[model samples]
Target: MAPGGNRGWLLRLVIAFSFAQGAVSMARPAVSYRALALGADERAIGVIAGVYALLPLFAAVPLGRRTDHGRCAPLLPVGVVLISGGCAMSGIANSLWGMAVWSGVMGLGHLCFVIGAQSLVARQSAPHEQDRNFGHFTIGASLGQLVGPIAAGALIGGRDMAGTSAFALLVAGAGGAVALTSLWHIESRTTSKSREEQGERVPVRRILRARGVPAGIFISLAVLSATDILTAYLPVVGEHRGIAPSVIGLLLSLRAAASIACRLVLTPLLRLLGRTLLLTVTCLLAALLCAGIAL
Candidate 1:
């Protein structure tokens, strides 16, 4: 079959991705609450949360490189397993260190799934259809992000914070497992067969030196750092302010919904301002938002 010839695979991929991302979304806040119930302070929470991204940061490039040379299908299931296990294990962990380790595992799993899924999309879509396919792909993530927190909030709360949070994590693991049902034949067999790959790998230095690469990386890093800090710190902030877990969850859901809204409007924004200006303006606004949040 020609790339993008059949739409069924795309639908399945989106469904699976939704479940996978939903699991991570639900687990993130649950992890924070569980850590707090186990006596974690703000600093401790920060460290543990930071560890979630640390493993992925170092592992993503290598994983991407491997995907470039091999089939992308295998990583998807491996990622799902790791994410589910990490969530369930983190629920049972009694100490901060153990939670941190499991959180890192979760992050690594997410990285794996993303790299594989993205590579799959790139390989399966025609050049002209790439933009639309990617847009559809991201909507799956948005759907997951939008729903996960609400579900988490609905489940986690009450005097037994630890118990409730642990329950939520277990549920998240189950939710991740749901993705496996959608994974049947998600990858195209044509691409999975080993063939002689064209060209040598691009040198890291040369790639980094390419025009706009640094700027794009820095922008992504900044936005990601802000988002991560917000997710990891919000529950602590809520505890300090006496806000309820449900309310925090609602706020997080609202934030995600706003992100979805932004994506919906992105085409118009790009048409009006073009990519460079739009990115610049958004980055500036993001910096201001982060500063305000800090205050």
Candidate 2:
């Protein structure tokens, strides 16, 4: 396919990613709150939340290895299946262990979808176009991040905690299914074979040891940890501050919008500050923001 021919597919991929990410974002806090409703203490809630990240940490490299050598599209559908089941199951699970298990499933599904989607983007775009294409791709993630929590906050509370929690999970399941619409024509068979031939199966250690890799990983981890903490803890902060749900939603959306704007102007930002300086500045600012939130 011509470069231009792939644009439509990329657009569809972005749309699907947005919805899938939105669902996961929505479900996460709902899961936490629901677990609390089921008599879980703060420690149990933390453990359940941590489980989402823990299992995926073990699975990501292997999944990446598989995608490097095989088809990316297969992971998309498989991820959807896992995400949908995990979200729905977590809602109905009576025990904390069951919720933790399903949360891990959801996290694994997220990792699979992201790895496949990113690999697809890398495979389809020319080297010169990679920066712009990736920027566009991540806009989908920002949109989901912007919208998901608001939807969750709106839907997830009521006089009946169990009932509201179940509803949130159902919505998440429906959101996961939306990804299926984009599966058609997402990956061409020819491209898959070519990717398998061209991509190297780098060991996790080597990938980590490569120049700039460690720094990039650390930066990504810090940024993500900041975002995760904000999402998971903000509502609790809001409660303490007596901020209404609507206000909290607006605040989160504002933060996401700022991130999207930053991404939109990333090229200019890089031109002004260079990569290392830009990363440093952003990380520093994010750290301050996180600290402010804590206070």
Candidate 3:
């Protein structure tokens, strides 16, 4: 079947992704709070947050290779299991190091889910529909981001910061589990078979040398680093500024809502400014915003 022929699977995929992303979003702030309550300072908190990305960094390529040669559907459940386990474990962990370890697990799980889902989209979508499909796919992430913080804010606040944050992590785990219900037959069997039959994988160096590839990678890395830092450190800022957890959550949700709005208007922006100018303008604006935040 052509990628755009039937979008029902895409809708289902979006729903599943929403829950998974939501769980991660909720857990991020809760982790920070829990760490703070456990006597971790800013530097220690930064290390824990960094661990959330570090452990997954090396695993991404291997997972992608595996998905290229095997089934994508299996990875989704595995990812969910890891995410759920990690969140729950993080909640119960007593020390900063233990929290870091579980945070790494959660990051690894997120990486797995993303790799599998992106591969699934590529394998199943027609070349012509790739852009549109990916846009739709990311809407799931935006939806999760929008809702997760609000939920976390509602649940996580009070004198017993540790206790409330732990409860929030547990709830996040439960939310991650909800994605399991939407994973029935998500991948196309025929496409999976065809991908397995393909020849040896492309080399990383060659891929990097391809036109626009390196630039895209760098751009993605920059945006992701900025976003991750903001997500992980925003709570710390709130704590220092005497902001309530509920208010912090709302602020985070507002950031997410803005992201969603940007995605929604992406096509129009592209039409108006074209890709190059749009990219330049957005990057410049983002850099300025970051600087303003720093100030």
TM-score of each: 0.96, 0.91, 0.94
How would you order the candidates by TM-score, starting with the best?
Answer: 1, 3, 2
- Residue-by-residue lDDT tens digits, candidate 3, 198-242: 787898788889999988989988998888888888889888988
The candidate that wins on TM-score is 1
Error of 2 at 94 (Å): 2.2
The alpha-carbon deviation from the true structure for residue 172 of candidate 3, after best TM-score superposition, in angstroms, is: 0.3
Report the C-alpha lDDT of model 1 over 1-295, residue by residue, as the tens digit. 5677786778888998999999998999989999999999999999999999999989977888788786677899999999999999999999999999999999999998989988888777888999999888887788888888888888888999999999999999999999988887666453542446546778788999999999999989989888888888888888888989898888888889999999889999999999999988998998898678667
| Per-candidate count of clashing residue pairs (backbone under 3 Å) | 0, 0, 0
**In candidate 3, which residue ranges exceed 4 Å CA deviation?**
1-5, 188-190, 193-197
Per-candidate local distance difference test:
0.88, 0.79, 0.87
- Model 2: residues with Cα > 4 Å off, grouped in runs: 2-4, 193-196
lDDT of 2 by residue, 139-193 (tens): 8889887887788778866567667877888788788889889776677632644
Task: List candidate 1 stretches off by more than 4 Å.
Answer: 188-197
Error of 3 at 288 (Å): 1.8
